[model samples]
Target: MSTATAGFPLLTVTAALPAVGAVATAAVPAARRTAAKWLALLVSLGTLALAATVLLRFQPGGDRYQLTESHAWIADFGVRYELGVDGIGAALIGLTALLVPFVIGAAWHDADPAEGDAPTGRRWRPTQGFFALILAVEAMVVISFAATDVFLFYIFFEAMLIPMYFLIGGFGDRAHSAGEEEGAKQRSYAAVKFLLYNLAGGLIMLAAVVGLYVVTADQLGEGTFSLQAITEARASGELDMATGTERLLFLGFFFAFAVKAPLWPLHTWLPNAMGEATAPVAVLITAVVDKVGTFAMLRFCLGLFPGASGWATPVVIGLALVSILYGALLAVGQRDIKRLIAYASISHFGFIVLGIFAMTSQGQGGATLYMVFHGISTAALMLVAGFLISRRGSRLIADYGGVQKAAPVLAGTFLVGGLATLSLPGLAPFISEFLVLVGTFSRYPVAGIVATAGIILAALYVLLLYQRTMTGPLEKEEIKRLPDLRARELAVVAPLIAFLIFLGVFPKPLTDVVNPAVEHTLSDVRKTDPKPEHPVADKGWFDYTPGGDHE
Candidate 1:
């Protein structure tokens, strides 16, 4: 369907505002680093305001892509600077916009030298560059979510790695007990690994994109990377290809998203990246950027290649189950708080993938909602963990004890975050996680049952982390003296916690918004659940009686 151009270019403006801010912030003099922070905040808030406008203007049960803006950029290749958002994309853009300002605030003092220490390395330098990189990443993330052109999406998708790489490698928090040299080396290793993994995926996807373009040109007499165009072609049977070729193309895209989702076997880079990067950057990676992987899986992989998606479902679902249990098991064993959170996200992401691949309306809707809920809950965990680590000058669980005695408010917030992670009832994640399981059960009962074990593992890890860190007696004088959650820290976490509760209590709005887009996506895939073999008897509920006559 062609885009409706009735309203303002809201999506474009929302995506571009951050880039503008990044340029403005980067132009500020190094001596005026404080001004840069303010500028970054202002820009981020402005973007957030624009994103809010998009959300407000968004019609919940409306078109698949709303407020779209399409202009020819590469006429020969049928490329356009196409931008728009379905409800899901709009919500994610809003989430990205919402988190950027807080991340800026959270990282405000990160670049400052520690007390009684002269600035010694790039890590101790001013933070203006960090803020600029964040804004840039935000812009790319917004565009990546909103882009309707596959090539444009790939550009934004690959482009995001640059700033994130710098954030992890250059400004990573050093382990408190490690020397500067050791920490720096670790950070570099993590950054390079992250880059290499994503680049490998991107390269494979690029080849797939080119192949898709060639196939489209051969069949339709034109090559295009427009998602709508390709989808239309596929629907019209003009984009037909051999089964092997189709599966290859689907695999190319799925492999990339799997790595980005950081699914089980491919998820090794995440813990290292999270363990090495600053908390704010880690928040961005885990909370916002990773959503792109699952989002693309639904949008591009399944949307473009339905038959291949169904063909690959069995293998994908098995891997997803492995991710769920394996990630949670690893999380249960982690001592580093950041790595624990990272592994938990892998487990959460496995649920998302399972839901998407389940090919049920409920599953896709839950997966989409899970993306937003995971963003909020994970941000809370990371921010709170960052606060604790900052005060204690350590990330090891063994380094903290009876922290609740010293910082009750902080401990309480952390516990709430932990509870959310474990999918406690009445929390946001529980709704989505439940929906995913129910949907998976309706289709793949065995995989669903196996994956449910991750919930027990989640509780084990989150509680263990809290118990060892917050519940014991205050033995270390240093631990006892740690300050409570400061105003800035509270400000960073309160909105996330409030969102978790608000969405938990009243998730209808988000689900309503997500359902239509998910339905549209599922319609494109054109897959349905297998029909039951037995006829149902006349009963209030589904009565599956063998040899029962139909009404």
Candidate 2:
């Protein structure tokens, strides 16, 4: 079970296929640029196929990581090349695989020349480099999710930033108001801001990793960075440390994840990055890349320092509430569509964090599933927004009017995505959002009640956006001639919409895959709900049980 049991090294191949495609795409001759695009698509589809295989092979109710591969690397330092996936990781990896091809397709014509530009004149083309960077990012993300060695995970985690930096800096759409020089400056500024924020967090976590290695060495007479080894040692009470030391180490890791999760006050960089990045890059960043932070929070922060996590719960829950309220308010007021989506993500992430800190199996399970649902729903919104921007030649909400008259399909798609964002009934996000609230309520009723207000705010923002952009009179000539969603666009969004409905109606399968992992994580953290101080009698004025009879 530890090694790739099948004939193929599935996880390694799945991760490496993208990199191989990147190299092949880059090696293609400049004259055959179209071939490079096809190559990237083929590679992405191939990776998706491999990911499906992993999913099919995955054991649904298993508590252990399956299809695992491990080998000794840096033996002197006790580092090993280890990769494995629990149910949670398997689902997210499947999400990553599913999204990349569509992202590639969405960007296919993104680099075309503007209207009235001379055909012979210099114009941007979707070059091999753009797709290569994307594939590179895919490889890194897959590796990060599959990695079981803390050091190995850190390596892939930091390595992920390089391609993403270029993707944001070089491939972003220039702001229309800003001249080329200013737009380039803005993109560069956002890219650097994103890089600096993540790098700071990564460095802090690196210190924690080194400290953990040293502590493990002191306790066991040999250092190790294997997640399984460290977790087992800590659980068995073989690796002990001072309370302060444990808290400090936990904070070191928490700081990085919180920044990446972009929880409230630390979330300033996200709006700028999302606003400046192209739609495909935005989808990747918001949908897949950002999940890394929360994933690491569940995988490392709680798993490695359960006591510290429990001790920090009150403060973490406070932060989560602030993020939920603050992000919603900002999103409601946003005029820029992209920045608005960015803020919405911050709000959704707040819910995810709240569930994680709720420290119950139900809450963690909901949080994990929320990560997947959010990716699907958000990707749809961003891509559709990109289409709208392309048509209107603007990103300002004020610039749109009567879009439904011009492109009914586009408007309808946006509405579907917006509805999903609001967690409307019969959509994928609703189930997870409901579970998070219920789980939180079961533990901290006051926080859960206050957080419920966010749902109302969500409906307001989504409907308001819809009303402003899609429901007005068709007065503008530019809007009158705009095209509806075309074949390619339909191809891109159809699966996402289908999934939103599919998961909404039938979430049991996904929850089944997620529950065991959630239970495992909760057990590792040793968290349980606090019992009520005063239990009410079943036949009395207040009955907490589901079916209490009143006299």
Candidate 3:
């Protein structure tokens, strides 16, 4: 899975361009807010082009790590400015880049007054700052995906919380039912809670990281945070750790990722953060930024501590099952539209983690594909929902009724997004969800059976939300005047919908890229898909002799 570094630094540039653009956008004059928005959009498009180039250059059958760039930074501390992309990293980088322009377009006028005509105490200038912060987050997330160095990844991994905090607090959703003062307090609280929870997780991971370096130093005669170096040493039998130390270190890393993954008990921060932030930023939270956690579970946790991951599988599977059922139940009960999506996301993350730990090629490949498709599908649904809320000025499901009667196009687009979320056939998520279940069933049948019920629950929430909002009688005056999506908004939702259908029908492009990486991960964890207890192929149409050698 390891490969020599290539001379070009495409991954570095892909990550850095967004950071540089954040600075440039923030520097724009206050009056030129539109210019700043345009600049941000352009920079995002350029980054997307670079991502596409990386994807094109990647060979499905090539080295497990491709387009690599490594250089020494803190030589004494064994930290290097190392960068590379496996298939999962490449695919996720594409997902992050793909979502940002749509986010920018969706929030184009969000910096305007919350009420069309209400004077309120404003704490900050949002115009340039809002867009800049998003670009900064995109930068950090991109690096987090591509960083092959554990310390390098953790730096950006924890750093993304800063911009996200401001996005939640300073530029909250304008459609709040609460008074401005109360809303501000809520946003501030959500921001603080989000930061504190993730920061605590990061601190735990920091200790694990230091422990890793210490272990490597003791056995290899030099400390290193390089993922490639450590993994190679273990493979070649140059470094080995006692069972107790590996398991403890693995817990430290896994705990941090689980919190960031926002599994079950640690997921409380998500609803508040998404509820308070603008819709695009909500998508950023679940769709773009939060992916780093699950990605890390595959790249760092399994890659570095395979034995510990294996030992902890039963406990991890239990937690994932809880998240799936728990998140789905809460989502079904949600009255607020944004919180519903947030809860639903927690459910989906559970499926991704389940697949990764299922330890079959289909499972891990599906997990990687789930990350990409979820981002696209969530962006479509959430952005369209944002547009609907902006027009009617409410996030409560009860506030909306018979939206299709007034704005059929908007309702229709929303319907498609919801259906995709429910994993309806011919949508991208269905394929990934199916593979996860099939893979999980092969090894852990009982866990797979319990997980399958989550789909039924997903159907209930998505359809119920659509029915209540789009199909009921046109009750309120505000709902009646809701206009269809504008050209700009259509531009965002249409392509996402198209990708959903295209990828759903033909996911081979993604699966092709993801399978090799999945294989490498399975090798790292020393796992293989379970053989069937009964073989159907052995007893074909007429060959049903009970005593025959079926093996």
Q: Which stretches of candidate 1 lie over 4 Å from their true place?
A: 1-4, 116-124, 529-551
Give the number of the best model, judged by lDDT.
Answer: 3
- What's the residue-level lDDT of 230 in candidate 3? 92
TM-score of 3: 0.96
Each candidate: what lDDT?
0.87, 0.88, 0.90
Model 3 segments more than 4 A misplaced: 1-6, 114-124, 533-535, 539-551
Better of 1 and 2 by TM-score: 1
Give the backbone clash total of model 1.
0
lDDT assessment of candidate 1: 0.87
Winner on TM-score (2 vs 3): 3
TM-scores for the candidates: 0.96, 0.95, 0.96
What does the lDDT come to for candidate 3? Answer: 0.90
Checking candidate 1 for backbone clashes, the offending pairs are: none
Q: Rank the candidates by TM-score, best first.
A: 3, 1, 2
Per-residue lDDT, model 2, residue 108, is: 85
Candidate 2 residue lDDT tens string, 274-310: 9888888999998999999899999988888888988
